[model samples]
Target chain A: MKPAIDVVRLARHPKRPTSRDFIEYLVRDFVELHGDRRFADDPAIIGGIGFFDSIPVTILGHQKGRNVKENIRRHFGMAHPEGYRKALRLMKQAERFGRPVITLIDTPGAYPGIGAEERGQAEAIATNLYEMSGLRVPIVALVTGEGGSGGALGIGVADRVYMLANAIYSVISPEGCASILWKDAGKAPAAAEALRLRAVDLKELGVIDGIVAEPGEGAHEHPGETMSHVRKAIAAALQELLVLDAETLVQRRYDKFRRLGAFTLDDGFSELI
Target chain B: MLTRLFVQCPQCQTTHFISFFKSADYVCSRCGHHSRLDPPRWIKQLCNRGTFRSLFANLKSLDPLGFPQYREKLDVAERTASGWEAVVTGTAEIGDMPVALAVMDPGFIMASMGSVVGEKIARLLEYAADRGLPVVMVICSGGARMQEGILSLMQMAKTAAAVRRLHGKRQPLITVLTDPTTGGVTASFAMLGDVSIAETGALIGFAGPRVIQQTIGQKLPPGFQTAEFLLEKGMLDIVVPRKNLRATLVTILKIHRTRPYPVRRRGDE
Candidate 1:
């Protein structure tokens, strides 16, 4: 029988692609960039220019450690404020170099430790948010695993956003939602359903652009299939987005984001936010 | 007998009937889960009668990304959740003081701050500051809008800059934290309010608790980042229940209504 497949296990324990794993899977030659320019380099978030399928693309993503010691070193894929700043730096670099930006979002979110905030965590994330919207590059973001929150959103803004079939994206986790709503986290399944967090659900809800097909069951089942699907989707999306001239691409990107989750009331009944 | 609104119990799968109006009066009975209420109902509950003028009332959403059938999906969500975008900005009178109010429309995408919502808020904050009005923002967000891409994150700086402007104008900016305030919105202006207040039992944090625990590979303490935790950590000044929010705002506003109003002069001057 196939191994017992828990989504969380797939998230935490799959013999999966590390951030560098994409270098081989997607990029041909990666020129690594380091540091926030204001401070020391953060190993947690690896970013730079790379050739994805020979298409010069800015490859940026979060790197988590495989073992306990590395996970600690990487902050368990939770980026510090500088990590985000580094991403912002690389994105701007891509803009300067006139390269299409492809960001792989794998972090749970930005680091929330006291040190991160003390060093302007909020400011870093805020600045990225500000600069990225106006950057002149075709951005295609993929949530390969856990797109937890702003940490994911840090590198997550793109002309086209895709999520792996088993990947989940939500403002918060279902367990957190359950604790908040039901006061009992055991009802996480209910919270998960209520959150509409699966790639399919998010795509259906118009929250995500598309869901890259995974291997049978989930991404963990067929790693090669998942990687191939991601590759194809990225190729197609980049081709589509790169067709537009810089101004049109940027404007379209801006407008595309300006409109999301809009609805009108039919009667006096309740509505979605 | 008042027909109870069919509230999906947060506990059991069964839907419990509660008086729509009265249950709207508070949280759910069976699970104590906060029932979703519209911005209008919320404003009515918190503001003086006939006192609100909504800003950006005509700011319709436009699809910039052209996600296929996005409009239809929006239609379904709007019908189901009953609000536009995820935030409603306006000027409202509370306890005879005109305050700029921005309430998260939780029914809409967990009150995610998309571009329109962020723009509306920034504009409202600017308007309030220009008018020298005190601002009261009730934040109940899941966070920045995923669909809006980088535009949603921009709201963080825009709103934060507006808040800083309000501070420069010497106007009070009160942020009321509500359930599920996480992600970009909380990491930005939501956490930057001058006098932060939270609803009882509200979840207030930058990232979700589960993500943190997962990242750290540890079990989180009970009530790790709730309103109580925030208050204890000095992130919040007060924690008020929904039932008491209006009176609390009135009391706080009355006590701090000096800067916005023209100073009274003595005859000696």
Candidate 2:
């Protein structure tokens, strides 16, 4: 029933565990922050100060609620511009206090509502990308669940990006892809297979740093074990990154991303020369 | 046999000659409906004669995800559009001031950014960094290509990182948003410009208006995601008519070339 062997089913479990599970099980004491300071607070993303193994860390991630009421409250984990702005503000705060920033990736995407756009959602995400790239602190991003597009990448670019074994990351969800390409949302199962959004595929393609293992059926069935695995993986990465100074850390991170996709030109096209 | 073909404008419902419509930059004479431009024609309109140097044209995409019919779609895209990816980036001169330019055309599979487009942008900006040239990117995209999956999504981060590196090096980035710049493209580098510009009637947003309407289950306001709407909302510096796009870039590049950007941060060296 758990479908652990089927990556799509494992990843797409409607009741798959959410980020609250991670913060609760992993962080010793977590205090959540609210608002982007410039706008109203967004419940879709949860951000604040937390201690990871006695080390102060800024924790941020998309928050999908457990029930229908919670989902409506959290906007089904679709972050708005304020959510990103809040995350950026927290990341900046973390930098000032020399705290490592931890982001848990899980979002279908940024909220696509009309108001979100008018309020500068693009500017917010772009600012995060520009600022986070140069932010002088250790940043770690883990794809704890559905890491979807710019909404996920809003906080996803980090010193290291990891994915839980059962997590899925994609530009567009299978349903959306199916609707757009084949004009049929019923073909989502086929679309999911074609997406190759499982952790294993992304890891092989050099899209993520590593894959954190899960204990049983996946995060939904074994949230505790999942949290522990993620905590250990993030701690190990932080230990490795904390050694270097700001300049070196930023440079190394940039270099790491810069080397992700390298395409070469074969000699056959030399006729133009 | 076929001497003439008339196409009706979607906005105005007016018929126009095919040759006349194309020569007019695909604009409707009656209603001023600005149609999308293809990449090669876009380059011709923006750059000096014989000055465009397309880099990384060989960085074509593969069917990494083994998505059904993706390879065949790529073949079709390559044949219909140019042999390049969604973005064509290179060093070119806007008049005398040499600028690094990236022009995305909706013709090339909706100018969607994938791994190749991302790599091209990152490398192009890096190239600009070495030369200390200004950047003006004409954006017309349907966002990230869904066929490439997460790899396409990663391009959002990768391209943003490139823009960051360019910014760290203190280069001027002027983003020109054209029709249909939405989704991942809008959420990343499309709005990161130091001075952002949108062409008149351009549709720019994180999501398509239809998607929003469906999500919220409501009727959208008229002219919701248009350039005029975005400008009123303070998202754009200004909206220029397509006719003035080249001149506007020239003016901006000239001023930037003359004055240069002041260093704004510590550790920028």
Candidate 3:
């Protein structure tokens, strides 16, 4: 076995692209929006109105840097409260204008600094969860990579949630999970198997709606081709969701989350075996 | 010739018989420390007599990862279990106001947030939102369950998402943080309440102080994560004594009932 692209291996894989890389691929002539208005602009999340095949859509996602300096600037794709606030502001704007929303998720999590907490990091994530559930617009979340914890979920609730073939989405990181469970971070690979965080596995668990195929090994190997695959998936999902009325869309979204996870825990667990 | 069982206060170096602590309702007699209360007794203490009706009692956790020691540990919890499976979710009356309540019990697996705990809390919140009832949650956790791996971790987001609906409606969500509220639970819904209440002497922070100390290699200041410090820094609204928690909750509920929606009672306003 070539050691399948589960979330754990995906975390270690050399070729995974960040959200910004994917945004460059998918968004065309995108006008960027900034600031939660109440707070200063956060660099970790990039949002604005963008055109996809002449169609206007509000595009938002976590952005990370390729180099050390950039990572420091981007916080390794982790968002602060302002980042979430900005996205919410834009999302509200999108709802008003009757535009579809396409959010790309790629973050280890929300920023956990003392300052971030003091400024209401958890509240921001919580607000998104509450507000996004009722947004009167079509929402499609694309987990490009590293769908970490509450940060990813900050922008993750949607009518349809899709994951890139190599992307992973879970409540916690594999390393964190490993350390807590095994008392050793070295057993992360083993923890990854237990997490069932890969797209296909999550799809089996019914956590994600579908998986967008990546090009050649993974998305980083062939970025352009990968974008094409993502572009097609987003187009199809949005087309379907856009037709539904606002009330129907919101109700469907709530019911979708409510029905998530197998009843009795074992029903969800039995699938893993 | 009576047999006496003594419990030691973890904070203070004082020891007392089980009866002494029980009569004191699990508070340390010497230092006024509130020992972690079990789920059933605490639930009874908070809710009106026979008014607490538990729901989602059948939802137990699954060992998805099949971690060697987890299932057996769960079985041990089950064998001597109270009415809840880590958390008690139900509708109860506090001072005669009907509210949907969920209390995390440290007695069961340290009141950890797992898939079931998250699900129960989320469902309860959504239920409260749908019915326009208030939500009262008592949070006491060691964070996420490690045995369930990522499934355990996802509870943070899942539960937070549920709390969002209630918060969005501006419904009263009274959260009482008991001893040692840390990790993902504290980082998510535990702190999202309209009024964040912490018991005195409770250790509340995102990361444990030891981790922070070791990571930064600094001798940290004392009382960094205690309720008094957090309250002084505006992280918590109130730090009520355990004896006053029930009365305080009742009064808060009364205020919630009488206050107008979208609470515009700022001093300047």
Candidate 4:
């Protein structure tokens, strides 16, 4: 039997999955896709088709390495413009095949290096936003861990969005936020609370559709249980979306975002009432 | 209580002495200018008469994040300052040519790019693209709104993408970076203009010089990331003063007028 799991330990000590572990555990019968066609394939974003309980789906995710060498190999999940282009390519393929796209969002955001900008990182992300809004297939994105800036949102637009309990989805990191707001990095926790970045807060704000239940307090406690819950949630979401036709799905997707912040004006004459 | 009458240029920070009650109109002595101009006033200065029509005038912000004391703070700021958000964007005519004008309201939250600001800018770009109008954005900001958090930062991408769509269509996007533009907003469309322009003495940079210096453990050079420095370094095409902004924009728009609207060949369109 596996060692007795400590919930606190699992929550407190979170680590990223390795390439092999991610491939073997999360993906079954996976077929790796390659290239942006215009440039060489970026190792930052790994995407293709796979099966979850015999249901075919497209899996797109940001990969992080276990060690220094592997981290360098994956550019520490920092993607070039081609990385976004590759994901774009796979998304188009998924649409063509009428498959639901399940994206695992885990990145510090797109690479902001000089090279990425020269190759039009901004342009690539813009293209994705324009193209994804019109995609025919259902998309369901999950924030398994960190969802950083445009890098995460580049592939994160979906009919239903889910986040793991302890995961964070933010435009910028807490440290970055603290630095910007307070001019001090030590105030990160203050920034974190101010950012309202946790899954719970996002769920409250309608930013996230749901929170995928993790095992024994967190995903790290049992990877198997976490993956199972994620698969089930995504499958259910996809099933619900698939019932609608393409036009309805598109309209629903548009309406979903449109209705996110529905509010009515409160006139200054409230005291008269 | 008598408020001090001072006319400090947003660009140069040059204080022009003026008597508090001399001009109720608040004109600067040295520069012969007003310290803060309303959006309509700026539009009138840049565009032909009666050409400007505001877009998304009905869109107001919602405190979705439930920011601590956000409503109270907003109310206080509203009471003390001009009744508007960060930016006002819409279609207008500069001389004979139809153009889109986006002017930042620095009086409001330091002209931070919150959701409404982002949405307005995006809609302006989309409208320009649809109608084949040239876009001119007068950027002045201390960057994203901390109260809005991630949503505010998303505006960086949102605005950049909106501008990119226009650019892809071969539409001209003229960014006139004004004083104190910094952070994520500057990192995006503010720097991605087809023909980038700046007001003389505007502070334009990804991060503030002080912040960058403290982070990098090095002293910044004199006039680092200023409009004059950026022009010398090729990040900006030209640096026009507040007095010349309207005329310079007209000439730039006129020069690019010869190019025909790009054919829509991209599949997404």
Candidate 5:
């Protein structure tokens, strides 16, 4: 297995294939949708209706710019309240049309800013989690890059969740965790290891269904090969999920998430009760 | 001993006798700053006398990832908070209206949600849904516990999904947003309440103020992320004073007790 810090570096590689690149590669005639309807459209998240091979799908992801100017435009892939709301809007539409919904996760978490909070960031993300639970459509999600805390989970909560081989999914960024734990952000490498955020680790922990293998070096080194793996993984997941009825799909999705977490019951507590 | 006798209000810097503050239900007598309360005090404030029966009190957090110092922190939290986890969940009676209640104690590592907290809360909701009881949650957290890592993040979805399930049963979830609700807690079940009420002067938002300041590199406007600000922004349904919270909740519970009017579906009409 790769060291956690190296995986983090590869995940944040500037040349890595972003959500837009994956969409372009996997989706044909992708009609990009815009705006949350309740607020201004956030550039950080991009979504649309498109065809994944022969099947029509609703696809969305956190978009990081390939360059500095683009990064500024995309807010470094950090979504605001409107971005989540827009994703939710498209998802509800997908459910109504009986289309499978796909989300690519890549964010350093939600934007922490005055406008974002004032516009109800928490409510926006919360609404997505609630609505997605009963979306009544096959849904698959891939963490192609940084799955940072709730921002990533905002669009995540799928029947099947996958992660790129080199991707990192964590409750908090290593730097943030380090600063809080040790009061020094320089301990991020150690924090990264401790977080067990590597794709393989997450898969073992049952946070993700599987890992989409990356190409030699990383996704940036071979985008075509990486996208192929992602496409295959998503296809398999959708195939499995599509067979279930809406009620079963939703219930199974609920059960899947319900099984996550680690705890122990005190000896005094009776489980049979 | 001196510190025990005289307590300073974090918001107003008003120093007063501990007994005096306790008598006021931890609200500052002069400036009206509501001090954080543990589960026991919160239960006393909200539930009828001798009516709160604690449930899921035996779930304990394990060091799932074996992260450094996590066990030590949990040990300290158990000792300091006098509870197994950050939240104390149970069935309680408010205004003689039986309801399921979950009170998050900020004293327990800032009420961070980890495996145990998530499990307790999800189980509480499931219990309430099974019995068709309303849920009243007192939410006060700094967000997902970092030590548990990705599993902590997963709790956000787990709890939110549980809330969705409860709503599916037509059971109401009334959340009381207390001081310092932020992060995953804000972005999950806390904000999913059918009626979201905040305590006056509570600090409520998705991101912490310090984080916003660090990101924007400027001083935040006064009263940013406060209950009043959320109310102005239309994110919250109401903001009630700390003393009046129980009465307001009782009223809301009573109103919810009425059977909801049947609505026509798209094809039914």
Candidate 6:
């Protein structure tokens, strides 16, 4: 197994294939959608209607810029309230049209900014989780790079969730965790290990459905092959998800998230206390 | 002896007799700053006398990730909060109206949503759904528990799905956003209420104020992320003060109550 920090480094590689790259390669005739309608358009998250392998689908993801200038514009792929609301709007549209929704997760969490909070960031993400729970459509989410906290889960409450081989998903970033726990940001490697954020770890923990294999080294090395794998994984998931009735699809989606937790019932402990 | 008898309000530094403060439900009489309350006090204040019966009290958190110091922290939380978990859930009656209530105690690891907290809330929602009872939750939290890692994050989805099920049954979910509701808790069930009411001076948002400040590299405007701020942004229905909370809740519950309808048998048209 790779050291968790190294996976984090690979996940954040400058040359890695971004959400835009995947959409451009796998989604044909993709028409980009913009704006939350309630607020200004957030460039951090790009969502639209597109065709995946001739199947009409709604594709959306957190888009990290390829260069410094664009990165600043995208807020380093950290979404604001508008980004989540836009995703929710597009998701509702997908449901109305019976189109399968494919979300790519890559963010450092929602943008922690004054404007974001003033516009109701929590409500935006909360609405997505509540609405997506009952969305009567096949929904698939792939953690293409970094899956950060509620921002990732905002678009991640899917029927099937997948992760790239080198990707990392965590409650908090390693640096954040380290600073809080160890009181030192430099202890990120140890924090990363403790968080168990790698794709394999998440698979074992049943937090994700499957892992898409990256070709050689990582996705940044072989973007074409890597995207092909992501395409295949998504297609496979949709193949299995499409046959179910709307009721079952929604119920199963709810159950999938409903079953995620690790705890023990200590009746004796309660009594002792 | 003076410190024990007189408690100083953290917000205003007004010292008052502990007895008087307790009688006031921990709200500072002089400055009206609402201090955080434990589950026991919350139930006593919100629920009708002797009407609260605790539920899901046996679910305890496990160090699933075996993160450093987590077990110690849980032990400390259990001791400090005097509870099994961050939330205390149960069936209760408010002004004679039966309901399900869940109160998150911020004293317990800042009431962070771990597996136990999530599972308890989810089960409470499910239990309420089964009995066709409305749920009233008092929410206060820092966010997802970091020690639990991805499992803690998953709790947000779990609780939200449970809330969805309760909504599907046409059962009402009224959430009382108290002091310091942020992060995963804010982004999940806390904000999913059919009627969201925040207490005055409560901090409610996805990201904490300090985080927003650090990200934007500027001082936040006065009263940012407060319950009043949320109300102005159209995110909350109303903001009530601590003293009026119980009465307000009772009024809301009464208004939501439907008239009794006759049940139809299988053969009856």
Candidate 6, B144-242: lDDT as tens digits: 999999999999988988998887667899999999999999999999999999999998988877778888899999998999989998999989988
**DockQ ranking, high to low:** 5, 6, 2, 3, 4, 1
Stretches of candidate 4 exceeding 4 Å from the true structure: A1-14, A18-23, A34-41, A50-57, A72-75, A93-99, A112-121, A180-184, A243-246, A261-273, B1-41, B69-81, B98-100, B122-136, B140-143, B153-269
* DockQ for all candidate structures vs. native: 0.09, 0.58, 0.37, 0.20, 0.74, 0.66
Instruction: List where candidate 6 sits over 4 angstroms from the true fold.
Output: A268-273, B1-3, B259-269
Weakest ten-residue segment in model 5 chain A by summed lDDT: A264-273
Estimated TM-score per prediction?
A: 0.61, 0.93, 0.89, 0.73, 0.97, 0.96
List candidate 3 stretches off by more than 4 Å.
Answer: A1-15, A263-273, B1-4, B64-68, B126-132, B153-158, B164-171, B207-221, B258-269
* Chain A accuracy of model 2 expressed as TM-score: 0.93
Residue-by-residue lDDT tens digits, candidate 4, A251-270:
57655543433222344221
Each candidate's interface RMSD (Å, one decimal) is 7.2, 2.9, 3.6, 5.2, 1.8, 2.3
Model 4, B70-165: lDDT tens digits are 677677656655565678877888878888889888887888777777777877888888888889988888776777866776566567657755
lDDT of 6 by residue, A1-273 (tens): 999999999999989989999999999999999999988899999999989998999999999999999999999899999999999999999988999999999998999998888888888898899888889899999999999899999999999999999999999999999999888999999999999999999999988989999988999999999998988899899999999999899989888888888777775542110
Residue pairs with backbone overlap in model 3: A171-B154
Candidate 5 per-residue lDDT over residues B1-269, each given as its tens digit: 44578889987898988898888989998889889888899999999999988898878888889898999999998988957589999999999999999999898989999988888999999999999899999999999999999999989988999997787677899999999999999999999999999998999999899899999899999999999999999999999988899999999999989877864532234
Candidate 5: residue A118 Cα off by (Å): 0.2
Q: Per-residue lDDT for A94-205 in model 3, tens only?
A: 9989999999998877776655655666567767876787789999999888888778888987999999888887766777777877899888777776777788777876
Lowest-sum lDDT 10-residue window in model 6 chain B: B259-268
True-structure lDDT of candidate 6: 0.91
Better of 3 and 5 by lDDT: 5
**Candidate 2 wrongly placed segments (more than 4 Å):** A1-16, A262-273, B1-10, B17-23, B260-265
Question: Candidates 3 and 4: which is better by TM-score?
Answer: 3
Global lDDT scores for all candidate models: 0.72, 0.83, 0.79, 0.71, 0.92, 0.91
- DockQ pick, better of 3 and 6: 6
Interface RMSD, Å, model 2: 2.9
* Native-interface RMSD of candidate 3: 3.6
Ranking by TM-score: 5, 6, 2, 3, 4, 1
> Which window of 10 residues has the lowest lDDT sum in candidate 4 chain B?
B20-29
